[model samples]
Target chain A: MTPLPTWQRGMRGWWRRDPAFRRYLLREATSVAIGAYALMLLAGLGCLVAGPAAWQRWEGLILSPVGLLLQAVVFAAAVIHAVSWFRLMPLTIPPLGRPGRRLADGAIHAGAWAASALCSLGLLGWLVYGA
Target chain B: MTDPETILIEVLRWHPDTPEAPWWQSYEVPYRADATLLEALQTIKDDLDGTLTFRWSCRMAICGSCGCMVNGRPELSCHLLLRDLAPGPVRLEPLAHFPVIRDLVIDQQDFLDKLPAVGAYLVPAEETEAAAAAPAAPSRQTPAQMADYYQYAQCINCLLCYSACPQYGLKPDFLGPAALALMARHDADSRDHGQAGRRAARDADTGVWDCTLVGHCTEVCPQGVDPARAINRNKTASARDYVFDLLLPGRRR
Candidate 1:
C-alpha cells in the first residue's frame, strides 16, 4: 500500500482544527461562563437569604477587583453567546413571516434588545424603588 | 496570452480516535472559470491524494449527493465554483452539524431515518383502481397557486439543510430541515391525502416543534426549498391542533 505523503499526514490535522470545531469551542466556552455566572448569582441569593450582614459581605465580595473582573469576563462571554445564538435564531425558533417575505433580521435583534432592556430596568427598579 | 487562476481549499478533517481529531488541510489547485467546487475536489483527489474521500454522482447538482460546507455555508459542491469564491482561498469541509465520515463526508444515517418517519413517499390513494381513474381530466392550476409552493417542490434531498441546522448539530435525533421540507412538500400538494403521516411525523422533539426557525437552512439551500417556511407552517398547524384539541376530536392521543 502507498504511504500517505508527508504533508497529507499533516492534513489529517484538519480533524482537530476545523472552523466548525473552533466555533463549537467558542459557543461552549460562553455557555460554561454563563453557567458559572448563574452559580454566582445563586450564591448571592443564598447570602441574601442568610442575613443582611451576609448580603453586605456578598456585595463587598462582588465589588472586589477579582469578582468584578470575573463579572466583566462573563458579560463579554454573554455578549458573544448572544451574537452566536441570535445568528442562529432563525433555525430553532419559528420563522417571523411568510415564505417569500421573511421578517427583517433587525426585528430579531430588536426583540433581544427589548428583553435585555426590560431586565435592566427591572433590576434598577428593584435596587432603587423597591429597596 | 493569459495567466491561469488558482483556488486554495482548506478542508477540516478528523478521526474519531485522535485526541486532536480535527484540523484544517489545504489544497492548492489550478482554477477554471467553469469548474465546480466538487470538480476541484475531484481533481485534488484523483491527482493529488487518493485518500481524500467524498461522495458524488450525477455531477449536475440534481442528485443532491455532493453537498458540504463551502466557506462556512452549506452548499452543493457541484453548483459552486472557485471563480465565484474569488482571489485566494475557499474553505471546504464536511457538512456542518454532522459527524465526519471522512474528509468532506458526513454521517447521513440519522438524516435518512427521519425521511422514513415522515412517510415521504407517495401512498397511492387507490392501490388497484385503474378502471376508476378520472378519464384524462384536464390539469387545473392558476399561476398564483403554483407560486405558493413552487420553489419548495424543487428540492432534491440534498442534505445542505442538515448542515445549516444547529438543532441537528446539538441533538442528532432532531428531524431536521430536508425531511420536514419534504413532508411540507407532500402536505402542500393539493393532490396528497396523507393526513395520518403528518400527525405521526409532527412531534415535539423530532418534529415541527424542534425547529427554532433560524432560517439558515433556507438561505443555504441550493434549490431554494425555503425549509424554514415549511417548518414554521407545519409548526403552526401543530400549535393550532394543540390549542383546539377538543374541537379537533381525535387522531392524536
Candidate 2:
C-alpha cells in the first residue's frame, strides 16, 4: 500500500498569527531594553571611575534629547517587563498562604505592585532629598 | 446584511488519494441560533457532502473528540454556537501544527505518544509486602492537596493546546503543553510518588523549558486547564533542581 501524504502546515510567521503570540513576543522583547539599560548603567559606572570630567561628559550625553528619548523607551519596556513578570509570578511559585487557604492571584499581583511602587518612590525620594 | 437563514462554512478539504493540494470547500449551512458548529458539520456530512470527513463524539464538549480550528483559533466544535459566528463565512480546518488526516481530523499520534513519557497517570508509592497483601484503602486527600492539582485534572486531552502552541508547530520534538500539564497534574497529586521518575522528562530540553508561555493554550482550552502555568511552574521546579544538583551533587534526587 502507498503511504498517504499528510499535509504538514509549517510554522510560517506563527508569532504574528495570534494576539497571544504577539503579547508573548512583546514580553520577551522587553528583555532587550532591560539589557540595554543595564549596559548604560555599567557605562555610567565606568565613566564615574575614569574621572569627574568623564562623568560630566557621560551625564551631558544622557541628558540630551536623544538619550532622554532612549531612556523613556527603556523605562516603558521596564514597566512592561515588570508588570508581565509580576502577573506570571504566582504561577511560578507554590500556592501561598496556610494550607487549605491559598492566597488569590490578585494578592500576589497586589503585593508585587506595592513592593515595586515603594522601591521606585524610595529611590526617587533619596535622589531628590539626599542626593 | 447577508441572509440570516443560512451561513457559509469554509472547510479545508484534502484526501491522500487525490494529488491536488488541500483547498477550501464552502458549504452553506442552515443557520440556527442554538445550533453548534458540530451540528452544522453534521448537516454538511449528512445532507450536503457525504464525503466530508470529521471526528465527533459526546457532543457536549466532554470526551474531547471534536476539537478543530474555527476561525483560525483552536476550539471545541460543540462548544461554539453558530449564532456567535453569524452572518457570514466561518473557517473550519483541522487543528494547527498537526498533520491533517482528512478534512477536520488531524493526526494526534504525536500527542498520544508523549502522554506516557510525561507520566500522566499517578504512580503509587512503593509498599511493604505486608501492606501490599492487605486490602488497599483509598488514598484520602485534603482540600488543599486536591486544589494543588484540581485545575490541571480538568484537561480532557482535547489537543487544542497543541494547536494553539506555536512552539509545537515550529518544533515537534518539544513535549508541548497538554503533556507537560498532565505531568504537572500527576506531580502535584498527594498520592503520586512519581515526581522523581517524571523529573527527567520535565527537566529535559524538550520539557517545560521549551514553552515560551504564549498562553494561547489556556485561552483555547475548553476545560480551562492552564498549560502555560503548569509548564512554567515546572520550569521553576526544574531550575531549583538544577541548582541543587549543581551545589550538592551527592544529595541529587
Candidate 3:
C-alpha cells in the first residue's frame, strides 16, 4: 500500500518564527558583552578581597595571553556597544530643535564621541586617584 | 520639457492560487516631478499589469490605510514623495511582523485583537447612589494633558509601528506599541480607573517582558506616540506594585 505524503505548510506560525527574532539575537549578543565586562570588574574585586599573593595571581592573569585576548575582545565589543548606543541616543530625546538641525549628522556622531571621551576620562581619573 | 527618471521598484507580489510562492517583481517606471510612491504603484497597476494588488485609501496619510514598506522603511505611500527617495530604485513590500494577506496588504487582525485585550475604552468606576445623584461636572482638559495623549490618540491604527517593532515580530501576541500607547492613555487618564486592564497588559510574557528596550517603534512611527517610553513607565509601575503597592492601603487602586 502507498503511504500518504506529509503536507507541506506555506508560512510557519508567525509567533514561532518571525522578523523580530533577529532583534532578540542582537540583544543576546549585547548582553553577553555586558556580562563579560561585569565579570572582569568582579574578578578585580575578588583579587582585592583575597591576600596580596592572590592579588598578584590575578594581576598575572590580567597580563597573561588569554586575559589579554579576552580584554581585546571586550574592548571590541565595547566599541560596538558605543556606536550602537550613540546611534540610538537620538531616539531617547525629542528632536533637537532648530539649532540641532544646523548641526550635521557627522556632528551629532562627533558630539556623542566627545561625551563618551569625557565620561571615560572622568572615570579613569577617579579610579586612578582612588587606587 | 522634462527629463525622464527611471526608478527600479522592487515589489513583493503573491497569489495564493499560484503554484509558485510570492516573488519580487521589478518594474522600471518613469518618475514624475512630484509623484509619491503611491503614484508609481498606481502607474504600474493602471498601465503595466492589472494583477498588481495593494491596499490604499484617502491617498493621504490621514486614513492610515496605505501603510507599506517604502524602500525597506515603513511609511505611508501618499506621504513619501518620490523625489526625496531618488536613489536609482526603491524597494516595496508588505509591513514586516504580520502575515501578508496579499501583496502590500497584511493581516491586521493580530493588532486589532490586541486593541480589545488592552481595554481600548474608558472604564468608569462604580457610580454610587449619592455620586450618581450629584450633578455631573464637565471634565475639563488642559492643553498640556491634551498634548500628552493627543499624539497617541492620533494613531490611525496603522501597522507601521508593528512593522518597525522587533518584539511584535518575535511574539505576535505582544500587543506591540500602538496598543500599549492606548493602554497608557487610559491608565494616565484622571477619570478611567481600569487597573485590571493595565494589570492584564503588564502580566503577559509576550506583553511587556518581551521588550528589550529596542525603541524601533518610536523611530519608525509617523506620529510620535513614543510607545517604548509608555512601556518603560509602566514597567516602573509594575515593579512598584510588586514591591510595596500591596503594603499600602488603597494606594495602588
Query: Which candidate comes out best when scored by DockQ?
Result: 2
Q: Which lDDT tens digits does candidate 2 get at residues B19-136? A: 3688899999999899999999999999999999999999999889999888889999999999899976999889999998788888898988888899888888788685587747
Which of 1 and 3 is ahead in TM-score? 3
* Runs with alpha carbons beyond 4 Å of true place in candidate 2: A1-4, B1-3, B129-135
**What is candidate 1's lDDT per residue for A1-131, written digit by digit as tens?**
65222111222333243455456567768989999999989999999999999999999999999999999999999989988877655544554566456576678777877887899899999999999
The CA lDDT at A30 in model 2 is: 96
Q: Which residue runs of candidate 1 sit more than 4 Å off their true CA positions?
A: A1-131, B1-5, B14-23, B123-145, B248-253
CA lDDT of each prediction against the hidden true structure: 0.74, 0.89, 0.72
Worst 10 residues of 2 chain B by lDDT: B128-137
Model 2's TM-score against the true structure: 0.94
Descending-lDDT candidate ranking: 2, 1, 3
- lDDT score, candidate 1, position A50: 100
DockQ winner, 1 or 3:
3
Residue A41, candidate 1: Cα error in Å is: 23
| Alpha-carbon TM-score of each model against the true structure | 0.62, 0.94, 0.77
Instruction: Rate residue B148 of model 2 by lDDT.
Output: 84
